[model samples]
Target chain A: MRNTWPGAGGSCLAESITRRSRLLAAVVGLGVLVVGGGCGRAPESTPEGGGKRLTIGVNFETLQTEYWVAGFEAIRSELKKRGIDVVDSIADGDSSRQLQQIRTFITRKVDGIIFVPKDARTCIPAIKAANEAGIPVVLFNRPAAETEGVRSVAIVADNRKLTRETVSFMVEQARQSGRKHKAMVVVGDLGDANAIGRRDGFYDAVKGNEEVVEVVSEVPSEWNQEKARSGVVNGLQAHPDISFIFTSSDFLFPAIVAALKSANKYHKVGTPGHVILGGFDGDATAYQMLEEGYLDATGVQDVYFEAEQSVQAVLDLLAGKEVPALILDPGFVIHQGNLHDLKDRMWGARVMGR
Target chain B: MAIGMRVDGWLPGWLKRGVLSDHLILWLSVAYVLGMAPWATGFVSVSNAQTILAYLLPVLVVSVGLTLVLIIGGIDLSVTSIIALASVLGAKVMSGEDGWMAGNALAVPVGVLVMLAVGLGLGAVNGFTVAVCRIPAFIATLTTMMFVSGFAIWVTLSRKIGGLPAGFVMLGQNLWVATVMAVAVTWLAHGFLSRTLYGRWFYAVGQNARAALVSGVPVGRVTFWTYVASGGFAGLSAILFTAGLETGNPEMARDNLLDVVGAVVIGGTSLYGGRGRVLGTVFGVLFLALVDNSLNLVGLTFYTITMVKGGVILGAALLDTARTRILARTG
Candidate 1:
């Protein structure tokens, strides 16, 4: 005779039932925790103006880089000072999950939404959903597609122009050297609009200067360090004479350094065998590299400026004020020439407490 | 006559040996290298060889461990996440800036041990879920992967931890050291699979779990240990990656899952389990590294390289199916 009691079972059937019950309990418990946590936040006290605190939902693609982390912190802290509450979500580079997050924010009745899209096109529906719920949406650092019947304020840097300016400085240096230099360009993921803009900007700067700087290789990094390292190593092997290197993002500097070191080419700017390096998105690493005389120039996106503008745009929309659909931050290229004067303005320098 | 028989007759006697039959991908990879040499500048040079080997070390190490899990009819989708988590955790212990053991002589060793411990602990959790709790390996490992990845990012707030001690970073910069580590791991794993009773139990269990249990093979123990071994190997791979990249990043190896799985499968590891070889996996890794290196040397776009890689993997899978059918007929 088989025992049917829950604790009496050494039998398979008893074990199966016990396991099922435990699993069910766990699932139910998790659901309750999620729901309770969502509803359990302490409400902020009303301001002196006798209005309820404004709660905003901010969705990020991924905080895998310093730029996104700085931007998120800036916006969150700045909004807190204004008595605004923030609910944050990071999609970790998943567009479908980002859409779901937006839906959750809508269900929570968030007053406004700010998001950095994983891609230009797939995130439009998320904006549309916010619009349908009568919530203002602000696109941060990345713009949505120009879909008719959709409205949102986008705070973005001019990636192409800034990249062109940075590369132009690299070109000027090459011209001063009075030699034709073989070049390698490390391109980022083509799916990202910023990556595309940077790549095009690189081409724009090198268009007529082919006589001074000839691009010998285009290494596609997909914003991954390992891929960048491998691509640079292989590119150097194929073109050993490459002296000019430009990467789409500053985060790839370590990878470039490693690859160049392996090839016995890494040196100071004034030293022989030194590869002239230029990067975009001036991060702390780029700042250090520039100071060390290893990096020639970097396209510095004003993260603090962009973050402030993004929040201001959302607040303006809530105030029934008209704003332009696109508020652009015309970023500048920082090189050694003006590093001393403008170091404070570079977000990466500020983050490093330099 | 069938094309296979005709081709067999054209082959040399040594090449027709049964041992050589398992290494068809090896010969094909060699042929590929020679074929691409003329078109791809510097494809066959010594410096390029170093690049391929250095990059191949981490992936190969992880795949070697993954092969054991596959042999036991289990899947581990969390190895990449383990690499990332282990990297950051270990980096934190040995980092030059305020690390737990900063400026201490034992920092490097202790940090390495911590990485291994994390891998083993995570693996044990997976083993317990699948072996004891009866959760499917796929679902258990998938959940573990998601949790570990998220936890890693949260620990560092997605900031990269750099400034590792020189002694620790040397392991990655020295090609000879990395090569020795990778070779030793592969040799030990191969010996375990071929020369031990426990190893044989893995194949038996994978072939038919119920039958193995009836045969008193300790199916649960074998399944549990296989995942643990895979995790430990991922930890070792993490050390190499963290040292090689010279930074501890939460996003390290995020794009390497396909390479790991693809290399193992292309090496003729049966996804359904019960059969695989360490040597075959080595050649599979070499084949992929060569393809990636050569495509870049040829200046092909990333899109083109991706499509070409996908095609190659598909062809290898088809070859695996044909090889299995031939072996069955011979038996």
Candidate 2:
């Protein structure tokens, strides 16, 4: 409605030109570096299974989230040992920017690229751009847009299977505890595919286990801790009778612990030791907490390994080797007894992450 | 209708006043409670109220300044973006383990000064655009918001920088901090509204810019400064909120604009401008916070809360119109 709402910021000709030039130069320089760095030479990379020292541009949907960070770390360590460089452009689950990062990788002409897209569908244009540029791509953690030529290798903890495993394990533990304790399942982001699977899986596991009445609460957190913190706190207060908070991600467990710890009722719930906080994606913090008697059990995920496997799949494509469209396998869940066994593996991964 | 207070002959005094009243705000609150009674009774509890208040403090702080901008018939969409920028920049400044900007140093007067200056400078940009360039407040603030958010996200790069020593999250998370802030902002905003000439000028500008200008008021200057003040308040909230979260995610507080607006509106401030009190906005904020807190305690979904909020806004609008009509006919 305002005709005189000042000209657009682009009208400042001199400043605009300067900013544009700088931006353009930066972009060009980045592209050249990516091409040079990724496609170095077959001569240098001769022995020990070597080729052009490829730079695999790996963009993640927020390395901040538990599962994705693990996946990225795995890719980084595996490739680092194999002499492959990875230029990471990580997004904190922003859909638009995730696509932009992917497009940028395409423009940079990297030897190969991998991405865990934010939205399953919106990232197609970016994926198509990489395809047009003849850059091999591998998607991990989450699925691809439409699944064309991009050798998508997701190292998913097989949500459906893990959900079943998580519930089954927790139920078994509860049954063994023999203490007629009821548990409430705190799900993060109920609408999510994995969340639904876990919810259904829990129901499947505990439907017949009459000991667990499954006192559900209102307002699913959508996987946000702040949201889940309140959800759990209220869940605890209203249904002090509830136990066994089976969540979707490790991110929510920390909040659940914080909430339950604040209430001091956390000790009263679950299998007499720690509350049964079961979920997928093996976060280091959650893993440690389990060993410390803060948790009963958790369904683990190999996020970093998954990302690495996906990257390897891309390399496989480039080397004229066969690539699978769906790389599906369930990562194992480690209890207190087995958590220590993962210590060496975790330490090794941490060292490699650097 | 018979008990209507009249001033202009049979004309009611309420009619002379614009759409933003305590009664109207109260009705909105009632509507929110009633419309989502199923969800409210379903989940929210006392502890849930604590969580909501914890999140609501930063939003209320920002809204305090936002009310000022709205009072002068302007809005600042840039508050959201400013928060993101401050968060990222704060992370960089406070990155050191025990350095001047890191950990224990966050409570020092120096850190406070830096925080204020950052907020003030960001606000000044919006002020300059609306004041010197004579751009509409909406357009100027919107562009600034987009630019600031973009830069903030770019600077942080998907990382949520944490480890703020101790007490970093106190200002945003502590009940005492929230109460102190709410009281202080209320007193300050009330003084600005009722005790200041510039504040009076803002009212005049909102009511009728041409009349205010003709009567020797500097409308542009008032509009500009309001934006600056709004931005500064936003920065302060950003710093406090970043502390509360204990991790500065450039992505944090991105969706809080809705709450800020809701607080001001539910407090009985007209989005159309010219008629709303800061104190009223504070009450509105508190009311919304109460609702948000109550939602969790009662076990309601985020989606259900949104639905309740919509109903509350509608109820507020209806009451505002009703009161306006009643006053006009009686007076």
Candidate 3:
């Protein structure tokens, strides 16, 4: 917001013009230097070696969360099984960064490109760019907007169905207990489609049961542990008698547990005065908690399977095979009872995340 | 003149003095908190106060060093990155991953040492770039900021590192301990700046580098060391922050640069430097914390809270400017 005077720093008008031009020249020079520094030689275009030895560029929305990290790890390991090499970069939730990386991948002429977009709309440009470069792009988890020349195959779990099943299970548990249900529904960022879908799913499940199951509090966490912790603390303080708490994801369970511990209200299943903990993103850590009876149920995204499927779709596309525009992989619910059976199927079950 | 003069029967000399200029903002904040007590639920409670203090501690610690840097006519934009870098390194050593210090009892002390050392070393880089290379402070520190931030991501691979020892974690959890540490550090800084000869060099150099050089003051050394000290404080803040969160996140202190700078400026520190106090920075920290806590207690919407906070800060700055003019006219 600070303005620079044209001739204040110089004595004469001509001198000022010269100074300004020099400054502009220096800035352009710096820009060129930076771009020049970033350049690398792209490997020569080679024929696909029986579809075995191919290089794939993978762009992640972010590796800030363990879920994404584990998902990427699964995709890499699965692709490695087929002797495929992955070159991955984290966008850190920046759309421009994601776009830039995709452009870099296109420049490098990687055999195939995989994108996990931070925002669906902002990913359109990147997808279009990849398409122009004749690179088959696969959208993992978050799909981009519909656009011409951007026919990217989308691989995502059914978020709405996932939450619906998880909440339906919670509703049944509340009914079996015969207690008036008081629930605190912790939503993630509304800007995120999954968060919106999950919130809608929970509300849809509880539509006709207002008398039996009351929504006491609804907090927006933006998928942050600290904010979620604060929300839980405030919610519990406001409604101490609430019977259940539903988090948008299992990633936030640590924050929920911390808040519960501070309030002296953390309890296991079957314990008197227990505040039932339910979450989405059926991570292995959450599964372990379910086995320990600390958690009740969660919606399982099965990130590993999703990863495996996404890589397969990219491979198929590379091999001139046709793939659907919208490949649906509906997730399921894992409660305390079935957690053991389903835990092994989860990528989260194998890797412990923060 | 009377030893203790008063304009009004109830208003003492000290009270009158405290209600002017820098101290005016502090008193206003206290009054604001108390005035909102009746309307805001639990705003005046001990538990709420501790929660507020816990959040305020790290920023306050960092502000002490920043205040010094500002007083010497320099700003370290890399303070936040230094925090991230120090925290990630500390967490890596203490994580007990791959037997590198391995969550042992000594790990806590070792982690603390690593954080401080890394902070100092990085700060020295900033100092060297500015003092030795003769680069402008802003551009020099900005360059360091980028590298340090990238280094942090490289260290942690952008992943959040947890598994800290319980003993170290306890330091961040106990509000009393954090509060005491913050106050002690602030008090020491205040004493050094006000009472020590070397500390006086900061003001002399900031006010006029050429004059200070003529007076045999090593202006470059003073400038360099201030940045190093700022880096050290940033490191200390990182430790406190990580201990509190029980995790090392590259994004933890990303938004704190504004808060630290704001605290120093609001504490009556001039942008051109040469005039400020650690005590004023302490007041500034408390004032902002009070405003934030009060706004939250009243359950204001996030956008409304942000607008109100901005307005309040602007109002304070305006009042200070008006007061200066009034004093000049009267004198």
TM-score per prediction, in order, is: 0.51, 0.48, 0.51
Each candidate's fnat, listed in order, reads 0.00, 0.00, 0.00
Give the best candidate by TM-score. Answer: 1
**Model 1 root-mean-square deviation:** 24.9
Model 3 ranges with Cα > 4 A deviation: A1-52, A147-149, A352-354, B1-331
Q: How many backbone clashes does candidate 3 have?
A: 1
| Pairs of residues at least 3 apart in sequence or in different chains that clash in candidate 1 | none
Candidates in descending lDDT order: 1, 3, 2
- The docking category that best describes candidate 2 is incorrect
The TM-score of candidate 3 is 0.51
Residue B235 shift from truth in candidate 1, angstroms: 0.5
Name model 1 segments beyond 4 Å from true.
A1-354, B1-20
- Give me the displacement of residue A50 in model 3, in angstroms: 9.0
Chain B vs. true chain B: TM-score per candidate: 0.94, 0.83, 0.92
**How does candidate 2 score on lDDT?**
0.63
lDDT of each residue in A64-181, candidate 3, tens digit only = 6767878787787888897886766665564434554565565445789887886554566567667767889988887765555468998887888888888888888887788787
Q: What number of clashing residue pairs does each candidate have, in the order they appear?
A: 0, 27, 1
Please report, as a residue range, the 10-residue window in candidate 2 chain B with the lowest summed lDDT. B41-50
